[model samples]
Target: MKVAMIGAGYVGLVSGACFSEFGHQVVCVDVDERKIRMLEQGEIPIFEPGLEKLVADNVAAGRLSFTRDLTGAVADAEAVFIAVGTPSRRGGGEADLSYVYQAARDIAGATEGEKVVVTKSTVPVGTGAEVRRILAETNPGATFHVVSNPEFLREGAAIEDFMRPNRVVCGVESKHAEQVMRELYRPLFLNETPMVFTSLESSEMIKYAANCFLATKITFINEVADLCERVGADVQAVARGIGLDRRIGNLFLHPGPGFGGSCFPKDIRALAATAESAGAPLRIVETVNDINESRKKAMAAKIIDAMGGDVAGKTIAVLGVTFKPNTDDMRESPSLDIVPALQQAGATVRATDPEGVREAKELLTDVVWCEDAYTAMEGADAVAILTEWNHFRALDKGRMKKLLKQPLMIDLRNIYPVDEMEKAGFRYVSVGRRAVGN
Candidate 1:
C-alpha cells in the first residue's frame, strides 16, 4: 500500500515510519522545508525513543521517504492521511481544524485515483464529514472515501503503541474504504490486533473520550494525593489497592504534579467545548481541566512552602523539566507552570533535564540551565523533582543533601519515599503521602 502522510509532526512522522516498517511505501509530507531537509539529511526533528532508528532503517530499505511536495506525494498514493495538528483554538477551547482543512483542499486538488483520505489527526466529531464535503466541493467528480482513524500513541512509547496497540479504531462509511483500511493494517490484523470499524463520529469521539478519561484518572489521583497529605495516608497504597480491582485498572493512577502533555490537556478542553456547543455539557471534563490547571500552580506553591514560604532570594533547583520521562517533549510540561511560579515567588531557579533542556531553554528563560542534576542542585536552598526520569529515581540522596544549602526536597512525582529521604537526613515532601521532616 502506498500512503502519503500529511504534516510530518510527531503523529505523522511516527505513523508514516511505522506503516513503512509494515512494508508500505510511505511519503511523509510537511510544509516546513527545513524539517524536510533535516529528515532528508537523516536528522530526526523529535526525540522519540527508537523513532530515529526505525525511520533510518525504513529509509535505508527505500520504503519510507520525506518530502515538502504534498501534491506529488498525494497524487500517487492509495491512502492519504491527514495527520496534521489540531491545536486548541484560541478563545473557544475547540480544536483548530485549519490544518486539517488545508490538507483536505490540497489532497483534493492532487488526488488522481480513488483514494482513501483518512483523518489520522484527532478532531471533533463530524470533522470527517466536513472533510468529505470540502473534497466534494473542490474536486466535483473525484471518487474518494473520507475515513476517521484517530491516533492513540503515547509520547514516550509512541512507536510501541503504534506497532502493538491494544486495539485499532477505524471509522469508515463504505465497504471499499473499510477493506482498504483492513488490508493496510493487515500486519496488525495477523497479530490479532482487533480493529473496530464504526461510524466516523464514533471513532472521533473515541479518541477524545479515551484521552479525557485518562486525564480524569490523573486528576483523580492528584486530588487523592492532596487528601492523603492532609489525612496522613499513602496514595501509592491506595492506588495499588484500587488498581488491584479488575474493573479499575491502575494505568494513569500515579499521583504527580499534574497531567501535562501534547494530548490530554488540549483534548479535554476541546471535548468540553464540543459538548457545550451541542448543548450537552460535560461538567466532569470541565472540572478536570480546571483541577489539572490549578494542580500545577499548587505544586509550585508546595515547593515554595517547603522553602520556608519565601523563595525570592533562594536558589531553587528543579530536577526534571519535561512533561514525563523518556521523551524530550516539553509541550505543556508542569515545569512550564512550576518554574515561572518559582521565579515569581522570588526564587532563582536552576534546572536540569537529560533531554528537555534544549526545549526548556525556550519555555524557561529566567532560569539558569545547568550541566547535570548535581550542577543544578549545587548551592541550592531546595530541590524539586518535577518529572520522574530514571536517573532522578536512583539519585545519590546523600550527595544531593550536601549540594543544597537547606536540604529541602519536594518530590512531586513521588520518586523517593518518605522513609528513604528521612534516612538521608533531609526534609522530604511528596504527593499523597506523609511528609518526612526532622
Candidate 2:
C-alpha cells in the first residue's frame, strides 16, 4: 500500500515510519523546510524512544521518506493521513484546526484517484465532516473518503504502542473507506489487535473522552492523597486496596503534582468547551482541569512548607522537569508552574532532566539548568522529585544527602518508601504518606 502522511510532526513521522515498517511505502509531507531537511539528514526533531531507529531502519529499507512537496506526495499515494497538530485555541478549549483545514485543501488539490484521507490527529468531533466538506469544495467531484482515525500512542512508548496497540479505531461512513483502512492495518490482523469500526464523530469523541477520563483519575488520586494526609492514612495503601478491585484497576491512580502533558490538559479543556457549547457541560472534567492547574502551583507551597514555611533564600533541586520520563516534551509540564512558583516565593531553582533540558530551557526562565541529577542537587537546600524518570527512581540517597546542605527530600511522585527514607536517617516528605525522619 502507498500512503502519504500530511504533517511530519510527531504523529505523522511516527505513524509514517511504522506504516513503512509494516511494508507500506509512505511519504511524510511537511511545509516546514527545516524539519523536512532534518528528517532527510537523519536528524529527528523530536525525542521519542526508539523512533530514530524506526525511522532510520525504514528509510534504509526504502519504504519511508520525508518531503516538503505535498502535491507530489499526495498524488502518488492511495491514502493521505492528516496528522497535523490541533492545539487549543488562544484562551479557549476549541481546537485550532487551521493546519488541519489547510491540509485538507492541499490534499484535495493534490490527491490522485480514490484516496482515503485519514485524520490521525486529535481533533474535536465534526472535524472529519468539515474536512470532507472542504475537500469537496476544493476539488469538485473528487472521490475522497475522509476518516477519523485518532492516534493513541504514548510519547515514551510510541513505537510499541503503534506496533502492538490495544486496539485500532477507524471511523468510516462507506465500505470503500473501511476496506482501505483494514488493508492499511492488515498487519494488526495477524496480531489479533481488535479493530473498532464506528462513526466519525464517535471516533473523535473517543480520543478526547479517553484522555479526559485519565486526567480525572489522576486528579481523583491527587485529592485522595491530600485526604489521606489529613486523616492520617496512606494513599499508596488506599490506592493499592482499591486498585485490586477489577472495576477500578490501577493505572493513573498514582498521585503526583498533577497531570500535565500534551494530551490531558488540551483534551480536557477542549472536551469541556465542546460540552459547554452543546449545553451539556462536564462539571467533573472542568473541576479536574481547574484542580490540576492549581495542583502544580500548590506543589511549590508543599516544598516551601517542607522548608519550615519559608523558601526565601533557599535553593531547591528539582529532578525531572519533563511531564513524564523518556521524552523531551515540556508542553504544560507541572515543572513549568512549580519551578516559577518556587522562584516567585524567593527560592532559587536548580533543575535537570535526562532529555527535557533542551526544551525546558525555552519554557522555564531564571532557573539554573544542570547536566545531571546529582549536579542539580549539589549545594541545594532540598531535593524534590517532580517527574519519575527511571534514574531518579533509584538515586544514591547517601550521595544526595551529602550533596544537599540539609538532608531534606520531597518526593512528589512518591517513588520512595517512607520507611526506607526513615531508615536512611533523612527527612522525607512524600505525597499521600506521613512525613518521616523528622
Candidate 3:
C-alpha cells in the first residue's frame, strides 16, 4: 500500500509512521517547510513515546518518508489521508475546517487516478460531504472516493493505541473506498481489531462522542470527589467501589484538576455547539465543559486553603505542570489555569515536569522553573502534585520535608497514601479524601 498523508502534525506523523511500520509505504506531506525539513532530517517535532524510534526505524527500512510536495506524493499513492488539525474556532466552538478544505482542494488537484481520499482528521458531521463537494468542484473529471476515518490515539500512548486499537471506525459509502481502507488496515485484521463500518456522519460523531463521554466521566468523578470531601469519605474508595461494577469500569474515574488535552476540551465543545445547531442541545456536555473549566481554577483554591487560607508571599512547589503523565503536550492543561490563579493570589510558583517543562514554559509566565522535582520543592511553603509522573510517585519524604518551608503536600492526583504522608510528619490534602494533619 502506498499512502500519502496530507499533514505532518501529530495525527499525520504518528499514523504515517505506524502504517509504514506495518509494511506499507507512506509519504507524509506538510505545508510547513521547516517541519518537513525536520522530519526529513530524522528530527521529530512532537514528543510522543516510541514515535521517534518508530519513524527512524521505518525510514531506515525505506518504508516511510516526509515531503512538502503533496502533489508528487498524491500522484503515486493509492490512498491520500487528510490528517490535519481541526482546532476550535475563535467565536464559535465549531471545528475550524479551513485547513481540511484546503487539503481537499490540494488533493483534488494532485490526484491523478482513482484514489481513496480518507479524512483521518477528527472532523464534524457533514465534513466528508463538503470534502466530496470540494473535490467535485475542483476537479470534475477526477475519480476519487472520500472516506471518513477518525483517529483515536491518546497523546502519551499514541503508538500503542495505533498498533492495537480497540476499534477502527471508518465511514464510507462506496465499495472502492471500503476495500482500500480494508487493505490499509489488514494488519490489524490479523489481530482481530474490530472494524466499525458506518456512515460518514456516524463516524464523525463517534470521535466527538467518545471524547465528550470521557470528559464527562472525568467531570463526574471530580464532582464526586467534591462530595466526598464534604461527607468525610474517600473518593478513591468511592471510585474503587463503583469501578468494580461491570457497568462502571475504572478508566477516567481518577479525580484531579479536571480534564484538559488537545482532544477532550475541543471535541466536547464542538459537539455541544453542533448539537445546539441541530436544535437538539446536549446540556450534560455543555455543563461538562463549564465545570471542567471552573474545576481547573478551583484547584488553586484547594492549594490556597491548604496554605492557611492564603498564598500571599508564599512559594509553592508544583511537582508537575502537564495535564497528565507521559506526555509533554500543554494544550488546555490544568496548569494553565491553576498556576496563573495561584500567581494572582500572590503565590510565587515553582514548577517542574519530567517532560512538559519545555512546552509549559511557553504557556506559563512569571514562574520559577526547576531542573528537578526536589529542586522545585526547595524552600517552598507547600508541594502540589499536579501530574502523576512516574518519579513523583515515590519521593524521599525526609528530603522533601527538609526542602520545604512547610511540610505540606497537596496531592491532586492522589498519588500518595494519606497514612504514609501523616507518618512522614507532613500535612496532606488530597481530592476525594479526608485531610490529614491540617
Candidate No. with top lDDT: 3
Q: What does candidate 1 score in Cα RMSD to the true structure?
A: 0.9
- Comparison by lDDT, 2 against 3, better one: 3
Question: Which residues of candidate 2, in runs, are more than 4 Å off?
Answer: none
Model 2 residue 414 lDDT score: 95
Per-model TM-score versus the true fold: 0.99, 0.99, 0.99
**lDDT scores in order:** 0.92, 0.93, 0.93
CA RMSD of all predictions: 0.9, 0.9, 0.8
Which stretches in model 3 have alpha-carbon errors above 4 Å? none
Error of 3 at 189 (Å): 1.4
Kindly list the per-residue Cα lDDT of model 1 for residues 1-438, writing each as its tens digit: 999999899999999999999999999999999999999999999999999999999999999999989999999899999999999988878999999999999999997758899999999998999999999899987898989999999988999999999999999999999998998899997789999999999999999999999999999999998998889889999999999998999899999999888899999999999999999999999999999999999999999888778887899889999999989999889889999988988889989999898899988988899988899999999889999989888888779878889778989998887888888888998899888783
TM-score of 2: 0.99
Candidate 3 lDDT score at position 414: 94
Error of 3 at 147 (Å): 0.8
